[model samples]
Target chain A: MAKPDLIIIGAGPAGMAAAATAANGGLKVHLLDDQPAAGGQVYRNITRNQDRLTHLGPEYTKGIPLADALDHPNITHVAGAAVWRIDDTPTVWYSLHGKSHAIHADHVLIATGAQERPVPFAGWTLPGVMPAGAAQILMKSSDLLPKDAVLAGSGPLLYLIAVQMIEAGQPPVAMVETQTPQMMMRAVRHLPRALLDRQQIFKGLAMLRKIRAARIPRYTAAHSFKAQIQDDLLDFEFTSKGETHHLKCALVLSHQGIIPATHLTRSAGIPHKWHKAQQCWHPDHDTEGRTARPGLWVAGDSAGILGADAARAQGVITANAIICAVRGLRPSIASHVNAHAINHRNRAQAIRAFLDAAYAVPPEINTPPDDTILCRCEEITAGTIRQAIHDGATELRHLKTATRIGMGPCQGRQCDLSLTHMLAAQTQRPIATVGMPRARSPVRPVSLGEIAALEQTD
Target chain B: MMTDSRFFRRENGTYDTVCLQIDGVQTHARATDTVAAALLAFGPAPTRTTGISQSPRTPFCMMGACFDCLVTIDGRPNQQACMITVQDGMCITHQAGFRPLEEPHDG
Candidate 1:
């Protein structure tokens, strides 16, 4: 491995951009990613699948140059490197090819990217039901697609995938949207601000036009939704405007929105604030991507849900900030270098305001039906969790101890947000005040043998 | 409950294919495939049942965030199928329940 002055954990847009920019600024950087390649989730397999994935659109196909930026001697990109832990000394503890290694770096930037927010519905854990993003991922990496796919829940990603599927010549059966017409009305006020970034708006509208051109059924304000396996397809039932609708499809892909993959950030004791707009725990970081903890920086969607373009800008901005700190370069110079990136980032974040308002997660998504499952690992249901809350498991910690909600292999990534919302809502308390799961050792599951074989590198 | 894979792979790629075994059945997967992807394209739905309720499950997040795709590969227990690449001759199987804890040996 190249001796790294800066370690960027995650080879997503932010990490890849930061690694290249920092290395160009005379710092040897080590970029580690869990995926087999450097293209993170947005452009997953962009390096390898660009030729055949034309249906994925130009933005995805255009990421190869950025992915290629790591082709410098100063940057060491390690694929299949699962980072399990980190510390204040800025040492990155990760497992690569079955061996654990703890390497020290002067500055550690976490750009681990975002994950699909888990909103449990009845029978969501069933075999044929999965996240909508999962379908996109399967298409991106494996060249696989589900012809009879039904997209439920609400967000930009659902539309993106629907358009992508249509282009792939395998249109989805239907889209049962959870966002109501009222939510659309409320979001209109922010449209002007969103339209400031005309390209982003046009991109969304173009996708909508394509989706309409394909003429797939789109149901809005869907509620009481549940998925069950019927014959060889997923039997999905939902209600909209008092009208019940049923769709039997080969697969049911669900999504609400995305949240920062904050397992590592929260584990590292970084201060996080509840982003009320996004309704998720967002790691607090400055514009330059510096956390309150010095030498520990966070950029990209992992910091918040600011799309790929902003993530790239934040990555460059953060790399410049790191350059200023590490090389004793002028901070003003770093700021100067990051000027354009900062402007682009501001616009992207502004555009997000309209999205956050429109697709604001339906309140019911967090509070699933009593029969719905809460923690997938434990198979604990909403009835059980609510009972635990009623049985004096009022606090987050108590509920976890009582029902084992957040104690799973995914480490609450699947259930933590819902758990927090459920507890606060059930108890009639404020959601923000009801804290979160405590920091745990492996954010990613690793074997006991692998831990015993860990070796430290200076 | 569905044993047939609901996923269909597009055959327009110029990529090489790799052969691996899923639950002792010989399966040919694209070299660009992950264990999870291969299972989706060729193997069964409800690839594995829940450790607690024995409820059938499949890989939820094709990203590594969800452990639904956890499978045993090359004698290792509880490996994330999405996190690893599909290799030729690699043995993969549906993981049921939690793996038994192996006792630590004296160093």
Candidate 2:
């Protein structure tokens, strides 16, 4: 494989920004993603027609800059390439449409992005149960909506999705939320930071106002008790303030938080730090997004879940840092005095605060209804998990070993964060003190046949 | 309109139901189906408990990576239902509290 001066692993906001900056700066750049197009999950392009909008309402995701970035001659974007592994030698091995290929790079920027955190419970594995992210995917990829859906869980995404649903004329049956007023109030410390991005603040505030106008019944501090498929509809059992209740709906959209996409990073043995504030795993890095290992740099959500704007800033800075490192040129001090530095720093700080305020999983979230199931794969129960804890597992890792919480095929992606929060609440320690379990491959539960096929060279 | 289950088929004999218990309630599941799937089929919205206040939980991502589906099985804690295969007579439990370590811990 021909080597590139810079290899950006992802085509999301961060990756595209980094790639554009690098390529425009005269470096040979290669951008790779597993998707068929350049936009990552959040800004996914559903059709060639830019006019097409999603059930998520207005087309907030303007892909013009990204499309323009793809037109650059110095940058080669490889789509539909699922990267399986990365070596410390800074080599990326991936499968493109079932063909084995590699990209050797002088410097690498891992803008691989973040994925939605799963909060597992009973009936979660049912045919109708899916993360709010999946719903977003369906909306972006196929313009589909879960018929008679109920959007639940916590975070900005919930309200965002609710607004989208209402705008799409497919408002969910109900919106069940776990975010307490206390949590929202506590998040006020981030207000100053939210001020920097007036547009985002206005847009987010507008969405919230719209949700209120839509009169979508939102239950803060309410937990989804049980989700089961009954009568071809999604049934949600909910509990709040020591009372248990049930609601029958067609689809349930739930989200806890998002974590850095660290499977590839961890597989390469990159050291990580568990960010308790964000409640997820992050690759350890310096001011520049370079990892502990040389040439194996990481940026954006692959490092932490700092939203799109933060991701973009991190990408640009990381790319510039990588360029300077590889080309043996010192970073221009004058650039630090320009709008670039101020804008980037402000954006990063604002997003960081927003993320810190936004990702908290409500404290009372673990109180499942007596009949609610906990582990969807093993069909476990809240009673069972509590019994194990009473038996003596204090930490998430130990709980994992004692009860197999994160060892499943999805590599604990589905229930680890929620488990960590449970541990933190029980132990009365800071959430940051909780340990994040390591991720393994294949990231998804692909069949052995798929693995065998992936191993075959073209 | 499009359901992923339309393509489902049994991998082994007996239709391969993966058996489990939800909140001590006995349940059966398929090998290919997640515990959440089994619970949903049996009639519930969630399969796991919450993080801070011990609320009921459910599957957000059928895939194992989401960490939202932690449950206990056969006395072990923190198992993700999205990843594990269902087996007959698998005693599953919900994870609600600070699950203690089964053995001595170094951290």
Candidate 3:
């Protein structure tokens, strides 16, 4: 196979849009996604699930065009390709069907996208507990739904899922939300800018209305959320409105918003900056999605926690910038800053500011109790991480060494936020100062056979 | 209308059901379903026990971020049930803690 001029690492909205934009500009584009289909986390399995999940609403259907655009002759969409590393040779290595393959492109785009923030709390690791978005993924991809699940967390997504379930005729048993009315009030300051994207605002409002219309029980200002198995179901407990309550249900779907999945970016040695509003580390990139590393770009949620629409627009902006570079043009977004996609991105980001303020991960969730397991892969407890911090283990590497955190296959994806916050809180420093862990290669676990196959290629 | 099952499979989905065995039980999952989703549709039950404390775990993240979904598929221990798509006749079993490190692997 001939090498492509541009290789996009994910097939999400960002990656797919970037591929179409670049391919239209005469670039041979290769787009790789880990899932069996396109549609990143947001529009996951869109091409197939679009008709099946009409209840998920029009926003879910918006991804259909993005998936369809991959048919452009210059764009090669490779699904089920788990990209684990981008070596300094600028070679993108991914494992497919148990074999490793490398693709060389003049330019690389990492659109690995976002993951639900792993909130550590008592009994979070219980078998019946899962990230609320995980249930959405299962529904989107596997045509399954969560029944009698309690939606717990702090994000618009929690409500969206509840509405989806309600539309399917099986609303969640209840919603125990951590975001208080006060948080929403604080977020009101960004209302003017948020109103610029009135459509999205209305969409969010519609979700809330649907949830209310369905009368799914909602508990606000909830904290101390925890769960355990009882009578073959999950018993969820939390303190809401200064009163304690316990609800038994078949499952507990937990979410605290999403953070960029920066494993591949961090593993590739790209610099990252911590977004205080999102309270996570995103790759250091410019307005046009250019990264610190020349010829490599990051767009979409991986660059930050921008929602799907902004991600699609950012993809266009990044692809245009790359096309300009390939053509030896100015490579500046200055001329088209007001273009349709650009304006859409700007508008979406405006609403993100309000969302960031309203649903910022609660401090209690960020800094879990000592008894909570912060690192699920290693089964390491928060107390162990705190003890490591107390022992002057300042950096992420030091904490890993002291408590085996981030040493598991997840490579700190699930534990990085919690560990950063704990180290910062214990040492009286900022989370950015405490820092995210230095992620290594094989961002997702690749079997030994996959790695060995790389050598056979040479 | 929704079914009463916790991990309920909805009707009129894109793909027809493909069968897979979870711990020797005959279970049906969508052809496009990942082994993780397969187990979840069959689960709320423990898919695999952890290697460290032997604590039972399920597919928590559904995305690859959480490794709790690791299960033995087709006699291959420690396959990420979320990463691989479900195939008809695939046999899946729980990874009791860690796999014996010397188990053979495929490409």
Clashes of each: 0, 94, 2
**Measured by TM-score, how close is model 2 to the native structure?**
0.74
- Would you list the C-alpha lDDT of every candidate in the order shown? 0.87, 0.66, 0.85
Docking band of candidate 2 = incorrect
- What DockQ does predicted model 3 obtain? 0.61
Question: Number of the top candidate by lDDT?
Answer: 1
Q: Model 3, which residues run further than 4 Å from truth?
A: A455-458, B1-5, B13-15, B105-107
Which parts of model 1 are misplaced by more than 4 Å? Answer: B1-4, B102-107
Task: Write one digit per residue (lDDT tens) for candidate 3, span A40-105.
Answer: 988988887666577787788889999999999999888989998887647898888878888787
Candidate 2 lDDT by residue in tens digits, A170-259:
777777777676776777888887787777777778988988888887666786457766665666888766677677766677777667
Q: Per-residue lDDT tens digits of candidate 3, residues B1-107?
A: 12234687777824577888988889788788888888777756688888899998888888888888888889988789898888999999988988886766553
By descending lDDT, how would the candidates be arranged? 1, 3, 2
Q: Interface RMSD of candidate 2?
A: 10.9
How would you encode candidate 2's per-residue C-alpha lDDT over B1-107 as one tens digit per residue? Answer: 32332112212224444556766777666554445445444553445555445555555554334556667766766655544546678877767754575643321
Clashes of 3: 2
